[model samples]
Target: MISNLSELLAVAPEEIDVNEPFSRLGLDSAAAVGLIGDLEHLLGRSLSPTLAYDHPTISDLARHLGGEGK
Candidate 1:
């Protein structure tokens, strides 16, 4: 997820703090939708367009998508 987000934002992977909100990382609505599209392609599954808004942070989203305990 960090790698994907970093690539989307054109930032180093390490620069993305998983706990930070996407808005704080400069992800606007369009970019959030784009990220969802990228994730859908990579995961080969459909995802909600509002997923980013629902999760809000990388760690949260990762846990939700990965089925990790949150």
Candidate 2:
């Protein structure tokens, strides 16, 4: 998930801080869609852009993808 997030955000995997905003990572809706597409393949479920909005950082998204979403 972290690797996916890093790829989607166009940053080094090590550079993504859970404390930082996703916008700072330069991700927009287009990238979110692409990321969701990949996630769907891995998770065997669809993910909406709303999930990207709700789950901002990699850690948050990891939790969500892990099926423990808030």
Candidate 3:
């Protein structure tokens, strides 16, 4: 997910902070929608269109998807 955000924001993966909000990384609505599609493909499950809004930070998103806590 960090890699995805990094690509979307045109930044290095190391530059992304798990605790920071996606908006801070310049995740506008279009980017968020694209991200959702990528996530769905990677996760192999259908996700809500508003998933990014519900899980605003990388850490929060991880927890939402039952991943290890950041």
Candidate 4:
């Protein structure tokens, strides 16, 4: 997911702290679309870039993708 973000926004992984807001990671509309496409390709399904709005931190997104815990 970080790779996708890097590819879309042209930002390095080291620059994006998992604790940092993706917006702080320098998000924009066009790059957001690119991110969505890349994520869909990687995840093999569709997801809203709005997910970024709700899950600002990458760790949150990882948990969301992980689904319910045992």
User: TM-scores, in order shown?
Assistant: 0.89, 0.74, 0.90, 0.74
Among the numbered candidates, top TM-score falls to: 3
**lDDT values, one for every candidate:** 0.93, 0.76, 0.89, 0.74
lDDT of 1 at 65: 95
**Candidate 3 on 1-70: residue-level lDDT in tens?**
8888888899999999999898988899989989989999999999998989989988898898895553
Clashes of each: 0, 0, 0, 0
**Candidate with more favorable, higher lDDT: 1 or 2:** 1
* Ranked candidates, highest lDDT first: 1, 3, 2, 4
Write model 1 residue lDDT over 1-70, tens digit each, in one string. 7888898889999999999999999999999999999999999999999999999999899899998864
Tens digit per residue, CA lDDT, model 4, 1-70: 8877776677786777887776788887676667667777888998886766777777777777678432
Query: What are the candidates' C-alpha RMSDs?
Result: 1.5, 2.0, 2.5, 2.4
Number of the top lDDT candidate: 1
What is candidate 3's CA lDDT for residue 34?
A: 92
Q: Which ten residues in a row have the lowest lDDT in candidate 1?
A: 61-70
In candidate 2, the residue pairs with backbone N, CA or C atoms under 3 Å apart (3 or more residues apart, or in different chains) clash, namely: none
Q: What is the descending TM-score order?
A: 3, 1, 2, 4
Better of 2 and 3 by lDDT: 3
